[model samples]
Target: MADATHSTGMIRVWDPLVRIGHWVLVVAFATAYLTEGEPEWLHVWAGYAIAATVALRLLWGVIGPQRARFSDFVTGPGRAVAYLRDLIAGRAERHVGHSPAGGAMTVALLVTLGVTAFAGMGTLAAEEGEGPLAGIVAQIPETDGPRAYTGDHDEDEHGEHGEESAWKEVHEVAANLTLILILLHLGGVALASARHGENLARSMVTGDKRA
Candidate 1:
């Protein structure tokens, strides 16, 4: 018996940078969460790692392999909507790379994670922390503008504005939300893989697949 989709020539799938960036982002995010606002040095390192991962992904998105570019998968919102409609009809198309919804999810995750990271870093550096960026933005009057975040003022030399409630609250909320996103991402990947006959986790790890 011959398989319907069998093909001897499996093509190269993932680029080196894409694979590295994906895993690096995962590890960096985990490290950041584990060390959030506690051990100053570890937390700062985690932030740096995540920032690096984001920067690397941005660069790779510009010059990476064929299937790794933003243009390759980040289709229009209308297309994404259409794809969702297909999913509802149980007729969603499976892509060798990221499907429409998955691609959009990737972009959303990157953006929201970036925002959460930026807010987290901003809050940490502004208040009672000694991050590398702490001294640079030491002059922004956070109270001058309406922000969801609030800073601390402990009169402590750790960058605390003076031990009031401010950025700390913001950081906590954002971190928790980021964790939720990560969980959702995992579940989505699992569901997609199970339904579509793909091993996405292995694809990211080995940079290849049974294509």
Candidate 2:
């Protein structure tokens, strides 16, 4: 399907893998975020789904169809900034694949989501001695009873506590950043759709755009 384009005036810009991965990320991220770490099973699984989807998407970006390849759309930050400027001026060009700004957003989303998911895993490992990072990230000591808070802690214990706190902070900050990016991405899509007189979101669903 690498060279697949239609003769009905529609071009197949996104392949099935890309489309599925995109939506999977959307649903998984929403589930993980909305659950807010409650119902631990659901949250952990949702996060795992997100991480897996992102890894697959990154692989696809390297070996998928032409339009799906990072080479086809990924551009420098300056280009993305210029594209945004043009978009705001209502003079941006329509792209069969992804515009410079859209490409940049795609990279940003993937990286941020990866960080958020992995950081959550680290937090889990440190707090519960679970996840892939278990035994790698220092696990908090388990206690059978409520322990008294003595202001005494070894340097190693203090370091472990700091690591756990850092992981939690990273997870929270990255998750919040992903939300901000998602809002910006949606706004960009809306603006581009209006400017181009096309349903960009619909194109993603159908995996095609006007040729």
Candidate 3:
């Protein structure tokens, strides 16, 4: 038997589900950010969409295709250190899926976004004076900052937003961090596509490549 050779770096990477979740999250994030105030209704929809996309992704990370699954790429610090060394030497092996560093980044981004989404929701509820945990949160300490989930929705509650301005600031910070991660992710894709002669972005769309 002989090994197979791809015409280009067109071997499939992301599955259909993975691609859908990726785009859904992207659009949701962008829409949420763009329509934050003037068109608040659209912004709220975007936030909900982002949260839903995260839920879908959580499922996919567990049972999706080999490459799409979290186990395929996530590595510990030791492996990450080695992967970095290889990259610096320009001798890094090209992975058909996400590189180890990319995997860590993905996980970080996912967890952060999930937290932001949930927290944002709480803030919104509090703003409406009917937060899910609104009654309970009133008891949190207000001296420090937003409590883990006190839900008092009171300003002085250790972690309550107490005001819309505070919520907006936190939301913006998370959004900015997300934007940076997205840019980094795209840059890495561009680099990989060029190095491997792959249309990484295109594969995410049609869910098919030379492979």
Per-candidate RMSD vs. true structure? 6.2, 5.4, 6.2
**CA lDDT scores, all candidates in order:** 0.69, 0.85, 0.69
lDDT of 1 by residue, 103-134 (tens): 88888768766766676676666654445556
- Candidate with maximal lDDT: 2
Better of 1 and 2 by lDDT: 2
lDDT of 2 by residue, 1-211 (tens): 4545688978778889988899999999999999987788999999999999999989999998888899999999999999899999999888888999999999999999999999988877766667887766753444222222222432465575322356778999999999999999999999999998889898889898888
TM-score of 1: 0.77
Comparison by lDDT, 1 against 3, better one: 1
Tens digit per residue, CA lDDT, model 3, 58-155 = 88888877777888888897876676567656677767677787787788778767766776665655454333445544545542334443334456
State which candidate has the highest TM-score.
Answer: 2
TM-score ranking of the models:
2, 1, 3
How close to the true structure is residue 170 of candidate 1, measured as C-alpha lDDT? 64
> Model 2 compared with the native: what TM-score?
0.86
**What value does the lDDT take at residue 96 in candidate 1?**
77
Which candidate model has the greater lDDT, 2 or 3?
2
